[model samples]
Target: MAQDSARQAPAAPAAPARALLASFLPALAVGIGSSVLYLLMSGLAERLQEVLWGPLPDALGIGPYSAVWILVMLTATGVLVGLVVWKAPGHAGPDPATLGLTAVPLPVGTLPGLAIAAMLMLAGGPSLGPENPIIGVNVALAFWLGHRLAPRAPGPLWPLLAEAGTIGALFGTPVAAALVVSEALAGRPMRGALWDNLFAPLTAGAAGAMTTSLIAHPTFDLGLPPLGHPGWADLLAAVVIACAGALLGLTAVYAFPHVHRAFSRLGHPMLALPLGGLVLGGLGVLGGHLTLFKGLSEVKELAHDPGGWTAGQFAGMAVVKLAALLVAASCGFRGGRIFPSVFIGAALGLAAHALVPGVPETLGIAAGVLGMLLAITRQGWVSLFTAAVLVASPTIIALLCVASLPAWLLVTGRPQMQLKEDGTAIR
Candidate 1:
């Protein structure tokens, strides 16, 4: 009887392993598919930008970097995006300010408008990321494909796989998706262990990350001096910088709804978007090209030679970038806020380092990123990972962890950067 029971247990475990492997195959395919779609969309935008900023400027006999060209391109981008939102199929879904990183899947038909708007925003230099719209497209397509191809597949699996895949592709890593999804799923009632639920998503994330790496090789490393050891002064400086960053982000958060409401009051895309673009252009003139786009490359440019910039210049860039983010988010631009917030954090960090001259550059940058990300996203784990990953410094990890406590306290119970329909803030 004991021998028979042992044999039966082994057989039962084999069944689960088989099931897991079966689920994993589909998840992997979904992840790869999602990554491919994301790459295609991003590639299309890059091609559009090359034409708009490269050959078109030459054809027009105007300098591509001139103020006039910048203004014309941005305004035209706004008009094109506005017309799409007003007249395209599905009306480009919902306002991004009211949506989070992940929402219910949009209809497949809505993907075309969203894709066009997102592409225009990317090429036209909006202070936004492709995270939201890309995820929407991935999710809708994944869900539709799953239903059509595998009717017996689990219903909830498609959305989870799509989200994980897109996040992995976006950040160029599976770990980011794991950390984000884990934080999001914490405390929810579940029938199984977290890792059990996570198994399929993780598979998808890995596939997505690998696919993106093979194609784009996206990275956030700043190539700063390595932080060797943590000192008392480093901790203190981190705290101060983090606190300051939190305050800066809070200012934006407080102003978010007002800006959103103001633009929304224009009552139509035709009036609102071009005006927003004009305002953005004027701000661009003030900020120069450094404050444009989603800010990933721009932040690197700012940090490449920190000694070249004055404290005042860093402050000005930070302020301008913040203003641009507010305008883009409020004015119906189709993109995400996280990348812009990350840029703002990097600018604030560099500004702090410039002003004080005592804080190490890497430490200041890491702390500033941590605090600003926490304030903006309210995701502590994601903030920590982003800050630490950018600098790739272990010595400052302890400092960043300590700084996050007070920064969290400041941002906690305050209005978040997101907007809700009820005119109240998300806390």
Candidate 2:
């Protein structure tokens, strides 16, 4: 009887295996879907910009009428917001400051709406971020499919897990996505559901990372040397740099909510959004044409060609860009701030590089990203990873991690903004 009982008993760690598979499969799916959707939406957004702005440049020739571009972007964005509010209610993704690390598992039906609207917003050049839409659509789809496939699966949580997993995979890092998810789910209990969350994101991260590796060797240029070898001076400088970064980040996080609220008070997106475009247009004139839109192209340019703009130019651009982005976002423009944030960081780095001659400009830029991320997201780990990844050097990441500690600490201690209700912010 004892032998029979022993034989019948589970011999292996079924939970672990199951857990692994559970997380992996959903994450992979999320990665695939995210990758495909990201490419599609990004392409669409890019093409839209070309179509919208193609003619104006030729008309201006040498001294392009950049003002028109900004106006057009604002106009387009306003229209997109109008469409979203009218056609796809609740398509606005999470509010970043208020929604750090939180995930509301949206219905599957909502995914299509969210995706389309999100694409429109992004294409229109809003001051939002892409991560929310990407995660939202992924989760929405996962829930729909999961419900259909496993009618007996757990509540809304399962779909959420799958979405989170997909995010993990799409991000090429499970932990960052997990951090984002955890932040999104803040104030909620994770007891008995921890394993489930872990499984999905891990699997998704692996698949996404693998896919990313195959398609594009993603590297984040956070200028730092390899781990275990950061010079003492570098360490000291990093600490100082981190402190500066944290302050900026905190400011950004706190201020952005207020900015959003200001725009929210305008009542209708149609009227308010056009005004935002005008503001953005003015900013474009001040910040230069590159500061318009998502700012991804700008970040790349800053990283590769620092000479493109001088120190004075960079500083001016940063200030202008920040205002433009704030106005654009508040006015109901669609798109993400991730790239713009990075651009802001890069601009800061460039400014810092001019001041601190010896240090690699990349490092300063990276530190800026770290600070901004920390301020924007209370997620220290994600901030660290994001700061490190942009440099695409693991050594730099390690070094930057150590270097940016002081700033993280300072920023972490400051007050943060929280969302109270629809378009409401509570400090």
Candidate 3:
């Protein structure tokens, strides 16, 4: 709330302190409201997926994950998404290639088209997550409505609250929202009382988390056996797996612009997206349905039955998922890379453990996720947080914190997966 209340520049006496109390109601509303929309989006997509992949496949007498069916569905999804991009207002919202985790709100006009495109992407099975567009949608809605509802609040206030709320809903926890938002605000010069400047956003995050928990009960725990204690070898496993995952992610990061340009050369979303869908279908066929969709559920599936897959199968899954993420993002899909990356990391981690029995499986997973998120998102706190959450072990938490250090170094100066309009890395 004190975004502009630096002691050096502020003229209002006790105003910054007063802002905290004044902001609580609006923050709570934004949090709860954003969580509602988040859940609605997820529910709509889940229902569509059940119909498309479940009933319709059975009714049509085709295996949903069969190679032929996978290709058709993905390719068809691409075309449907292409039509949305070509015909929908705001071109189905901005090209995801040129965006980050959060941005200033888009026009309310763009929301419907963006929502449709994102839902199609989710239900239609391109290896991506709801996070990016969901945040965009929530932020846009909050900014648009908050102005009319709270005319006296700062212009930046609404989006921040919504962003925090959406993130909290996504993770079903205020911890993630706090870490991520605080990380973003860390270096910016701001005047504030000792109380968290992120009070309003944090409040919104708590509300959102509580709302999501009440409704969905989502969790990150992958059901991996606990890493009860750390040892020297376990630490080494964490370091090696994390660094390996980072390198693997960087390969995709470096290749991102090339893949985007390759699609860009096709000259239009209508032309490029279908072909991208075709590629994703092939990947899905190779990786199986377990590697499809946002990786959260897939990772859980993989974790539950680690022994069901061989080392080679796990390795193939990881590579295919990474390739699918690259193609999906490059080809104009509206989603985030984070969830898919999680799938890749889980696959890779399991592969590592399969190849070398000495590495503790939980430690391997935490480190692998730590590395992948580091290279992909480049958000240190969020990376560490996500990796630790997956295993839900206090011991792995400490191990991942140590694992993140060298892993961070590997990705620090490298190109991020995000790009500019010209298809170059944003850095």
The TM-score values for the models, in the order shown, are 0.94, 0.82, 0.96
Please rank every candidate by lDDT, starting with the best.
3, 1, 2
CA shift of 298, model 3, Å = 1.0
Total backbone collisions for each predicted model? 0, 34, 1
Q: Taking the tens digit of each residue's C-alpha lDDT, what string does model 2 give over 105-212?
A: 765555666667666666555555566566666566666776677667565655455555545544566666666566655657664556554556555555655665
RMSD of 2: 4.6
- Alpha-carbon deviation at 101 in model 1, angstroms: 1.5
Q: For candidate 1, what is the lDDT?
A: 0.86
Tens digit per residue, CA lDDT, model 3, 198-315: 8988999999999999999988888778887688888888999999999999999999999999999999989999999999998899888887788788888888888788889999
Query: In order, what lDDT does every prediction score?
Result: 0.86, 0.62, 0.89
Please report how far candidate 3 places residue 346 from its true position, in Å. Answer: 0.9
**Top lDDT prediction, candidate number:** 3
Candidate 2, residue 7: lDDT: 93
